[model samples]
Target: MDRRGHGVARHRDLSRTHYRNGVALSHETGSHETGSHETGSHDTSPQALTSVLAASAAGARAFARTTSEERSGMLHAIAAALDAHAEELVPLARAETHLPEPRLQGELKRTSFQARLIGDRLRQGLLADVRIDHADPGWPMGPRPDIRRTAVPLGPVLVFAAGNFPFAFSVAGGDSVSALAAGCPVVVKAHPGHPRLSRRTAEVVAAALREAGAPEGVFALIEGVASGVAAVQDPRVRAVAFTGSLRGGRHLFDLACARDEPIPFYGELGSTNPVVITPSAWRSRAEEVARGLAASFTLGSGQFCTKPGIVLVPDASALIAALPPVHSGPMLTPGLTDGFRKSLDELSGTPGVEVALVGEPLEEGVPAPVVLRTTAATVLAAPRVLELECFGPSTLLVEYAREDEVYEVVGALRGQLTATVQAGPDDDELALALVPLLAEHAGRVLWNDWPTGVTVSDAQQHGGPYPASTAPATTSVGTAAVARFLRPVAFQNLPDAALPAELRDGASGPRLVDGHLKTPS
Candidate 1:
C-alpha cells in the first residue's frame, strides 16, 4: 500500500473462507509474500486492493471537510438507510455469525442507534469548545488571555471490525460513527469470518454517503489480514480503532509504535469482565444474582467481549445453593467452542479448582455454558488460571473467605472494560469505595446492572486501561468515542479566508463567537 493520502495503493490476493473446529473449509493456492515494497503476487490482485484503499482514504478526507451540520444529516440518513436494509443485512449476519435472528436484529438496531447518536451529538456540537481560566485581579499582569480547547480531526482512521457484533462493530458501528463525528475519514478492515455481511453493510453506508452528498472516500472496506496490516502501517493512516483479541491488537499496536513516527492505536482488547457480589447483596439476592449471572454468561453464546468470565462470591455455600445448572447455546464459531472445552478440561484438572457445573459440548458449532468454582487462594496461587480468557459460554466462579480477600483479588485484576457490583441499599459505602478501585482497574463501573447492555449515551465509558484497551481515557461507545479520531490545532490569529471553511466566521462554517463555538445563525 502506498502512503500518498489515497487509500492503501497496493492490493494483494484476498478471498473469504469458513473455518470449523480450527480447520479451513476449503483450500486455494497462492504464494505468500512478505515485505514493505512487494506487490501484485496475491490472488485478489494488487491494483484492486490499491483502488479500495485509495477510495477509502478519499472518503475519509471528504468526511473530514464536511460541515458539522452536513455530517449530522449524513448520520441520520445512514441510520435510515440501515433500517431500510435490515431485511437484507439481518439474515446475512445471522447466517455468518450463527447467532439467532432476534439477537442479530437487536445488534443491527444498536448499530443504527450508534449512528443516530453521533448525528445528535454533531447537531449539539458537544466537542466544539471547552474553556479554562486563571484570572486574578491582584496579579501584576493587566489581563489574562482565555485558555480554550476544542477538538479537531486526527486524519484517516483504520478500524478493525470484530468477528462478533458483525453489525454493531462493523462498517457503520461505533468506531465508524465516532470517527466520522470527529471529522476523520474511516477505512474499515472487514473481519474475514463475516465478509459477505460486512460487504453488504459497507454498501449501505456508501449509498447513504452518496445520497447525502457526502464524500465518496469517507468510508471504505477491505478484506484480508495483510491488507489490514498495510493500512495500519501506512503513513496516511493517523490512528486505529480495533475490537478483538489481545494478541491481534498488541501486534497492531507494536507495528504502529515501531514506525519512525508512531501514531496512536486505540484497541479494545480481550477482557475477563469480572463481577463482584458483596456479602450483603449476595445474602439478600443470591438466587437473583445467580440467575442473572447465568443469563449473562450464556447470552449470545458468551461471544460478547463484555461477557463475565469471572465471578467473585464470598460464600461458597450460598453461591452453590443459589446457582443453577450450566446452560448455553451455540457459540459463534466451532473452533472457539472446541477451544473452550479444551481449556475447561485443562483447568478442571488443575489441583485446586473444582467443577461446579459441567455440560457436554454440542456437535461442532454448538457450545454448552460451563460454570467452574474455585477459591480465591487457589486462583491467586495459580495465576496462570487467571491469565487465559475462555472465549465461549463459560465462566469461573471464585469464592472468597473474607471481604478483605475480595478486595485483594479485585486489586490483582488487570485492566477491564467493566467491573460490576451487585450491591444492596445498605452497601453504599462499599459501593463507593469499590467504584474508585474499579475505575482504576476498568473503563466502566456498574451498579445493579449487567455490563452486556451497554448504552450509547453521552455519559457512557466503554474502554479501560492496558489489556482492556490501549487508551484508558478514551471510550469505544457513546459520543466521546469520536475524540479518539481527533487531534487539536490552534489557529493563532489566522485570517478568515486563510481558515478552513469549518472554522471560518461567516454566514457559512463553524466558529467560536463570544466563547461559544457554533454554526453561524
Candidate 2:
C-alpha cells in the first residue's frame, strides 16, 4: 500500500514510531531483525516478542486502511522482488530443508505465483464482497433502511510457519500471502527446523514490502516455541494460520480458544488422505494405480500434510503384487524423524497390520518408505492406529472383500484434506454415491488422480475438519484463503457519503450487489 496518499502518511508515521520502538528494542537485546536468533530460540527476554507483536498490531491498522488497488500493486512488487532474489533464497532453502534444488526452485516460483494470483484477485476487487441494499419506503416489515455490507480485515494474524516446503509454506508463504491480501499484518513464528533460512527469507520479504510502500511492522518474524504460544495468546493477535502435525496444530488451536477474547485459528493439520479404488480401476490399470500411490506417498519423503496415508481396495493382492519399489530418504528434522519412527513402530506393531512393502531405512534417523496391510474388519476394530498420520514415507493398505466393507472402512475414516476415488467410466452410479460420502469426510474429493501436489487456484481447498484442520469452513490455500482474515461489517442507514467507498450506491466497481455478483456495482 502507498504510504504517501490520503492520510496514509499520518498512519505510516504512527506505524513508523511503533516500528522504530521494536527496532530499538531488537538492537538493544542483540536480536536478529525480528527477534529470531541463530539457534531459532528466544535470544532475549519476553519483552522482544511482546514488543514485536504490539508493533505488528499497530501496523495492521495502517494496512487495513489500504484499498484493493494499493495492496495489489504492493503484492505484485513483492512477487517480482522474490523472483529477482531467488538465487539467494532457493539455495538457502535447499541447504536448510534438505530439499532438492529443482523442487525448491519450483516451490519458490509457486510461492510468488500464489502471491501474484491473490494480488490479481485483489485488483479485480473480489475480496470486498460488498453488498448494498437500497432504502425502501413501504416495506412488508416496517420501513427497510439502507444497509451496506462489506468485509473488513480481521486485525493482525500470527502465522506459524511449517517445516516442510520451506519456500512454499515458510516465511513468505500462503499464510503470509493471504493475510497480507486481506490487509492484516503478519507476525510469522519461523519454523525451528529452518531457522537461518527463515530469517533470511524474512529479510527479503521485509525488504520487498518496505520497498513496495507497505507500512512499517506490516510483517515480522519470530522464533521459539514459547513465543509461538504467547503469540496465539496475545490479545492483539486476532487470528492464526498454521501447517503442522495434529499435536502442534491442536496445541495452537487450544491456546487460541483459551485466550481472554479468544480468536479464530485456521490450522492445516495432518491428514491420512485416504484413497479408494474400485475393482474395475484395479483390473484395468493395476500397475498404474500402484505406481501413482507409490509416488504420492514417497513424494518429499512423505512429509506433505496431504499425503495419502491409506488405500482401500477390493483386493489387496492385486495392488501388493503390482506395487513398485520405493526408497525412503532423510526427513526434515531430527525430532520429526523420531516421531515418524515412533508412529511407524506403533502401526507396524499393531496386531492385524502386516508390513506389505517396507522401504530401506538405512540410517538411525531416516526411515524407508513402508506400506502396511490389514483387513477391513481389523481396521474397524483398531481405527486409531490405522487412522493416525505417519509423518514419513509410509502408507496403509486396507483390503476389503465387498463394496459394503469398502464403505465401512471409508466411513470409519476422519476428515481429510483430500480423498481420491480410482473408479472407471462405467462406475458413474457408484461414483455418485461414494463421491458425496468422501466429500463429507474431506475438503476436496478427487477422481482418477493423486493428491500429492496441490494446485493454487480459485477452487482449491487445503483444509478439512478436526485432525485434518482446525477450521473446516476455511482453506489455507487459493483465493478463498483471504476470506479467513476478513469479517463482514453491515452499516445500516448510511448515506452514500457516509458509507465506505466500496459499499456506496452507484459506485462502479466489482463487488456483490443485493446478493448478486455484478461488475461495475
Q: After the best TM-score superposition of candidate 2, give how far the Cα of residue 378 lies from its true spot, in angstroms.
A: 0.2
Judged by whole-model lDDT over C-alpha atoms, candidate 2 comes out at: 0.78
Instruction: Please name the candidate that would achieve the greatest lDDT relative to the true structure.
Output: 2
Where in model 1 is the C-alpha error above 4 Å?
1-44, 58-62, 130-149, 359-365, 496-521
Query: What digit string (tens of lDDT, one per residue) describes model 1 on residues 22-63?
Result: 111222244222121112222222344466556656666566
Q: Say what the RMSD of model 2 is.
A: 7.1
lDDT of each: 0.72, 0.78
How far out, in Å, is residue 156 in model 2? 0.9
Residue 140 C-alpha lDDT in model 1 = 60
Best model per TM-score: 2
Residues 252-365 of candidate 2 have per-residue lDDT tens digits of 789899987989999887788999888878878788889999889999888887788988888887787888878767776655666777888888889998888777654555
